[model samples]
Target: MRWMQRTWIGSTITLALTMLFLTGCPKRPDVVETVPRPMAPQGEVGMPTPPPLPKVAIPEEKSPTEVAAQPSEAKPTTEAGAVPEAKIAEAEVKPEPSAEGKAAAEPELALKDIYFDYDQSAIREDSKKQLNENIEWLRKNLAGKVTIEGHCDERGSSEYNLALGERRARATRDYLTAAGIGADRISTISFGKERPFALGHDESAWKWNRRAHFTPSAK
Candidate 1:
């Protein structure tokens, strides 16, 4: 009976030691579940892809340079009928021929006036020099035609002075026609006791009024 009691006691102690060993060791921590990260798109099975790159521009190769034209060598502008620039420049610079055998420019007056005595239609000796000068001027301007105006002082009857003025104009015309001026190129008019020059009633005014005046005739 004592050997059984001892065997029972040994079994109880062995069970108590196993329970203490299991309680004495530290406990393992609780396992945590991790969230998955976002990923780039897959091109194939495993590799991820980026955005496409822009196209690159390549420069073209240049052609070889040709020989330049010389300075003296001018190119043709038109067909064979066209005149060259050099010839045109020459024509522009070339001087023209002047009028042959022409005299110098005409004098400003071309012809001069002649004075006469009161109540006389005769040409005076002093008046001869001026009359010759008028003839020379008329000859120079061959295209020129003239009219002789006979003016008189405010004296005598108007009718009498008009007759005298006509006589004076005719006498002057006769002198010019005889001196080689054309008869057709000469004309005579009488303004008797009218168109006085000096404006007073003296001999000085009368001498200037009684004269032959010349003017260019209209064509």
Candidate 2:
């Protein structure tokens, strides 16, 4: 009987000790269940994709003939007070010389003759006046050239008259050269007894024949 009682108390104590140890230990965390979200609608995951735009067709290029058929841009018209371009061009271009201008360009009068004493090459005092008049004309018309034609009376021999006439022409030319006329501008020529100014053998005829005449040349 005493042994039975001691076993029972010892067993009771052991069971109580086991219960206290289990109570002192830490508890484990509780487990939670996870649920998956419903899948998004087919096109709504991010931004909805825009529907494809309808394609537009480009027109073909026109032919050159079709382009030419189009109306041209209008040109500006001249104002009422404005002058035409053609008239302005004509006005800018100078007109040719008139009849009056042509007439004025030519020399108006001829030079006077210079008479000399019979068979003499010396220029007379009266002839000097004529030469002065010629000089004035020459100065005005600088381009003019002259030939000094010396003549003789029929009384002298042809050869002698020719030689004398040349002397007279040379003397006349020398006088002109001394008076500022260029030597190149004055030319001398002798028309002997073969060509006489007056037909008769009298002093009047000889006086007229023994003279120096001025003839203009173009050169």
Candidate 3:
């Protein structure tokens, strides 16, 4: 009985000492370690690439000579006051008409004496053409004044031939006035057998002597 009691006491003291030793010592905390990761390239190494943008055609720029070679809108060209060579020469030089040409143009204007039959005051058939020509001349020269001298053949008295000559002169004046000549532009005179164009006493001389002569004067 004494040996069992002593063994039980030793076992109880050893269990108590082991529990006190465990309670007296402090516990240690757990330690955590952080690991650094390696950096990757752009878009992660094996990412898919987007499709290339649709290719657009770009026009090339042209130089001055190349642009000028292209056809452009049509524009009207001007002479800029430049006269033609032919016109300049024509303006600078002109040829005057000759005196012979003047004579030709004025031949119709030369006043010709219109003859009458023996002791007649009426206009003769042959004298119509000559009278018309004289009227044309007077019309062309509007500023010309005319004197119609009436003549007679040497066959009557001085007073009687003068009356006849006056009749002839009046007849000539009437014809001229009726053909559009102004009466104010004409003057009448009697030269009854005083001035004879043909001196002989024949039909030719008498015909020439009995006439109306036109003398023109410029205004």
Top candidate (lDDT): 2
| Candidate 1 C-alpha lDDT tens digits along 1-219 | 999999999999988998898899877878898879667466856765777889889876555442333245777568778887889999899775443312234243555667778789998888878889888888978988888888889899899888888888788889998998999988888888877878998887888888888777864
Residue 48 error for model 1, in Å?
A: 91
Colliding residue pairs in candidate 1: none
Of 1 and 2, the candidate ranking higher by TM-score: 2
Candidate 1 runs further than 4 Å off? 1-108
TM-score per candidate: 0.50, 0.51, 0.50
Model 1 scores worst on lDDT over the 10 consecutive residues at 99-108
Q: How many clashing residue pairs are found in candidate 1?
A: 0
TM-score of 3: 0.50
Per-residue lDDT of candidate 2, residues 1-219 (tens digit): 999999999999999998888888867879887889776665896856778789999898899999999999999999999999999999999788776675456543457788888778898898898899888888887988998888888886899999999999999989888989998898889988778878897996888898888888764
Deviation from native of the Cα of residue 129 in model 1, angstroms: 1.0
86-163: candidate 3 lDDT, tens digit per residue: 898999898876876764566533777788887789998888888888888889878878888899998888888888
Quantify all predictions' global Cα lDDT against the true fold: 0.80, 0.85, 0.83
Residue 139 lDDT (model 3)? 93
